[model samples]
Target: MYPPATRAAALALLRRGSSLNATSVALGVSRATLRGWVRNAGAYSPRVAARATCPRDRELDAGAYAHLLGLYLGDGCLSEHRKSVFALRIACDETYATLLDECVESMRAVMPNSVSRNPAPGCVHVTSYSKHWPCLFPQHGPGRKHERPIVLEPWQRESSSAIPSASSAACSTPTAAG
Candidate 1:
């Protein structure tokens, strides 16, 4: 597996109009491999790296986020291990689980409101913070809920099916009926 940093470097070069064939030859990697790396890099890079800033600003929301974050920070002990998981993983398992739960819940509560509307239209800094903690924490970020279809009751389905087609439904509008 290619390291993220090296892959990022390769992607940067590729984005600068470098040919995949040339890059592969210079980097001593297959053209297809280089292309794959670039594709993966694009998957994680800021969604709007090339686009202008968003029209909706959130400077005013800073106070609200900070207040919630402060409350969250106050819940944990100051001396607790908050570094790499490998380091923390070596510590007590129970403690780690508790801290993980607290962190994930705190994040889930604060981020969706602080970040942006459903499916953020542009890159947001909250994504980076989320990367640090992901465990049953809805890693896809806000506005991106897992799409599981709701099981409908047979009667409910049949009742809905009895309704007329969309065109007829529209024609039943109060003004059209009058």
Candidate 2:
């Protein structure tokens, strides 16, 4: 077990706006331990969650993210739960197992976590929950997407254009390996 002093130092560094990686490096603690400390202390706010899990805070795999973004804009929706957590749900046809796996892979590439596959009559709802979905996919992830003002950012346009149109996956990033 880590000492309480060490835990406090880690938390202090995190609260002072240090990235989890930076905090762990500076204090010689694992990122998992730091994340657990934050979880145990109930500091899962959006900002905290984003810093901890957002790909933007680290070396982002632009190609994977671009594919995921394309898939999301075309077929996914976001729902907000308590504690500011959001769920990104992509509807996939159950018959296409390869497509389902691809969706799950891209989601993990963007943010590492356990993604749930909810089966329906003919489709699977592939979902992963996080408090930073809106931050990563700010265009649409919460509420009725039709009600929201959707505008594609220039970078998103360029990224999507350079990619193989959402169905093809690409690249590797330093995932948390959950």
Candidate 3:
């Protein structure tokens, strides 16, 4: 049996979106052991119940949100998993190395606690255990965004219209020929 502190630390890490394997390694415990702690902790821990609520209420960077929105439009999707866990999956072709970097950077900029993982070949998943993910990426809907009409919320529309000047400037900046 683990000490209360050890179990708490393990649960804390898991609550913050750490994977079972990662948390187990950090706590020097087997994945099965950690899983047991998680299962038990859920029965008595407030944090388990809190997971169903929004992580935070704060303003999002318009530029970063715009970039994330663009990425989503191109190849991203938001999915709901068991126990209120939500994930944003951006499908990147393995051939485009830079695309994955961009997606990872964009996700990190928006959700610092989020960690990107490769759940499958050529796909990067940015997942969090927050109920507020839908608030940040309001593009969540019933069907594929293209098949159905994607109506943006007022804030999304405003942010999209306000894509920063730096983005436009970067596009216009001339590159030197080697």
Best by TM-score: 2
Error of 3 at 32 (Å): 24
What ranking emerges by lDDT with the best candidate at the front? 2, 3, 1
Highest-lDDT candidate: 2
**Candidate numbers, best TM-score first, in rank order:** 2, 3, 1
For model 3, the superposed segments whose C-alpha errors exceed 4 Å read 1-56, 119-129, 164-178
In candidate 1, position 115 carries an lDDT of: 28
lDDT of 1 by residue, 38-64 (tens): 545432323222211111121212332
Question: Model 2 over residues 1-178: C-alpha lDDT tens digits?
Answer: 9989999888777756687888889989988888889987656543454445446556556777887886676667777656777778787777778878988988888777678999855677788887767777768533565556778777666656777664442222111111
**lDDT score, candidate 1, position 8:** 64
Q: How much lDDT does each candidate structure score?
A: 0.32, 0.70, 0.59
Better of 1 and 3 by lDDT: 3
- The better-scoring model by TM-score among 2 and 3 is 2
**Model 3: what TM-score?**
0.56
Q: What tens digits encode model 3's per-residue C-alpha lDDT throughout 17-132? A: 66777777888988778767766654222333234223334456677777777766656667775564567766655555675566577666666545555655444444433445
